[model samples]
Target: MMKKTNYSYIGIAFIILVFGILFVPKIVDRISNNDITRKESRSDQKLKNKALKQSDLVFIENTNNGENRRVPAFSFVNQYGKQVTNKDYEGKVYVIEFFFTTCPTICPRMNNNLVQIQNTFEDFEDFGVASFTINPEYDTQEVLKNYASTYDITNPNWHLLTGDKAAIYKLANEGFYIYAAENSAIEGGFEHSGNFALIDKNGFIRSRKDAFGNPIIYYRGITSEEEGTDDNGEVEQISILKEDIKKLLNE
Candidate 1:
């Protein structure tokens, strides 16, 4: 009986030795080669890669000078009645829009899209929005403040700016090439493009190239992501704009 028990113990020890010698090193090697990751971890890694897998964004250039167009210098009072200038956005990636609080047509849709963007980047301190009211005469700091509240605009960097009418129009029409003018024929008594300009950290305007390889220059802002396409068949660019903003932020 004693001899038989000893044989059984020795056989078990031999099998354990074989396992350590034959399999342990391969397990260690798999770990070292990153081939032993969990399924969840692999999925997460794929998502990270996809998020970062975007083509380079292009700088919108001046037709006459062949130089990168930049956000021109301007100063205006924010919703909080604080002075804001281009200097305030020096190292930030921001969106610029011309809007008014009392606008009855496209402005609401444009701002709703912007507010969605604001929520998406709420955690990113360097992301912001500059809403220049085309009707600054009516959109005083108080009215702008009320509008901000109504829209639930919580990002401290987002400024609903209002100031000199002439300067604002110049910034819209000449500086950014987004039209903003008084038009009694328009429903809102003012007319402006429902487009948003994207600016990089260094203040240069940036955009993704179109299918034909030209800079799209402006992103459509009047359509919400949920709406997808409008009555005129204009597809919403907000989703792409958000992705491009992420690219600029990473840059």
Candidate 2:
């Protein structure tokens, strides 16, 4: 009887020992793996949130010919004779527009808008503005220089760029998503639409605006315009977009 009792006690102890050996490591491993997974999940969520917020941004639509579209890689030289590429404006709010120096209608208003923007952020050092002339052939460095002088655009942050006709057209169509084409025969040398493209710091198309909050054009570039521009059209012109830049700079 004593032997049997001892054996029974030993059996219970062995069972408990076996359970501790088998279950403890598994529990520890599960918990450790869960922690790692949760950390990764949080990191991934942050990236996703950034991307989604980028998508929510609104910018002037890219009018390819007449239809709205997204822009492609644009490269040009500013009045200062520096090669300006899409890569230069990363991590900053960039105001891009398609215009010629001699434009009688929309170009002047666009420049005025840019001038106001320069004044608004005269003290701001992070944001930037770039304007591309559709008539690159006539709007050469000298022509741009005269135009810049006329507007008193002294801000070092502003760039008036002129480059190869094909390159500029490509940039207008591809980089900035504007209606730009080479037509020396035309009175202006080239014909393109009037649109101001507002790009966020991440280099994604955020919102496109006309003179004011007018929804003359709107496209996000990643998705269809009809779909992408729907959610963002409610926000007033440059006001919300400008605030976004301020918030980003603050961050």
Candidate 3:
């Protein structure tokens, strides 16, 4: 009986040793490879994406009235020679830029970035662009049309617009708060902001907040995604702009 009891204890000890040798290393290996934590992290990310909210973006406000700022009403002739107004862009997400076809620098880069953006959302009918030419006198219907063709502007909603110079300037300066003036001293014989304004489907200007939680009113358009940063060491915002555009579209 004593020998039988000792043999039973030895048998139980052997089984425990075999179990540790067979399974313990695999569990340790899984932990070392982060197999368990990785799945948990992916699940957490999915939950966060599902909870996306409209508050992720900021509504640019009118400093004077402290109300949400909106794109002012305006009328202009598009590259196709059709009249377009603020009402035309209702229920659409569009980017606004002040550029002329004859610009010697910056304009091309800006438009190239815009072209990339246009292609990114080619399937979305509500995505559009409004290129208001500061030099309306020179960028007539024909010139704007040719420029659009050269840049491969395929989006039907993209409108290279030109009209009364004063109205365009008013739209640029007072309406959008983007600087635009006839400056012969500049290389392009005109001066305008190289930033782009983002408008939501409701015609209200929208933008993402900065590091300090302040609305970054406009996106830098001069730097391309490939460039990442310009000669002046300014970081590119095109990627972030695209992300924000998606956020608004989903909203």
Which lDDT value does model 3 have at 4? Answer: 100
lDDT of 2 by residue, 13-131 (tens): 99999999999998899778988789899999999977765543344444556443434566788887788877777767767777889876557755765676677778877788888
Q: How much lDDT does each candidate structure score?
A: 0.93, 0.68, 0.94
RMSD (Cα, Å) of model 1: 10.9
Q: Which has the better lDDT: candidate 1, or candidate 3?
A: 3
For candidate 1, the 10 contiguous residues with the lowest summed lDDT are: 32-41
lDDT of 1 by residue, 73-175 (tens): 9999999989999999999999999998889999989998999999999999999999999898889999999999999999999999999999999999999
| lDDT score at residue 182, model 3, on the 0-100 scale | 94
Ranking by lDDT: 3, 1, 2
Report the Cα RMSD per candidate: 10.9, 9.1, 12.9
The positional error of residue 196 in candidate 3, measured at the CA in angstroms, is 0.3
Q: Give lDDT: candidate 2, residue 12.
A: 100
What tens digits encode model 3's per-residue C-alpha lDDT throughout 146-240?
99999999999999999999999999999999999999887989998899999999999999989999999999999998999999999999999
Let me know the TM-score candidate 1 reaches against the reference structure: 0.78
The TM-score obtained by model 3 is: 0.79
Q: What's the TM-score of each model vs. the native?
A: 0.78, 0.61, 0.79
